[model samples]
Target: MPKPEHPTDPDVEISASATARELRFHARPEVTVHAEAEPGGECAWGSDRTNLPDQVEPNVTYRDIRIDFRVAAALTDPTQDPSSP
Candidate 1:
């Protein structure tokens, strides 16, 4: 049987508490990634401390966090073709 076709645009949801110190993202099967923090929460992207919120109250749970993923590059032998088996 043939493999099913995956959606070109996919939705990914992440949940976390306000007290969470940091959030990290790792690219899977690709070298590039894009993500955004949903509204109704106090948080920011990247490692620069200046960009983060001043305070994150404890016991606060955040929902509807969404992230998007796409293929930037394949991790494989440079001499080999990426599409080759």
Candidate 2:
């Protein structure tokens, strides 16, 4: 296999994380890979927030994350609509 590039699909690897003296937390949830337009081009991107069930304590944040890991663009045909199913 060819050596992978510095930035590959799922290029910007991101995850839910946190730190604090009283950081009650959970194992980072599974990720949600997505496609988006960047300054140079389109790329796979992902990001997640700290998973907290409640404002059970001080200094906390509750949020959501989306997920998908398709073989995006595995078949790019010049004649087919990329968005068409």
Among these predicted structures, which one has the highest TM-score? Answer: 2
Candidate 2 Cα deviation (angstroms), residue 46: 5.7
TM-score of 1: 0.18
Model 1, 45-66: lDDT tens digits are: 2221222332434444434333
Q: Ten-residue segment with the worst summed lDDT in candidate 1?
A: 1-10
State the lDDT at 66 in candidate 2: 27
Candidate 1 regions with alpha-carbon error over 4 angstroms: 1-58, 74-85
Best by lDDT: 2
Clashing pairs in model 1? none
lDDT of 2 by residue, 14-85 (tens): 333343333433544554545544344434432222343422444454445222223222223457665689
The lDDT of model 1 is 0.31
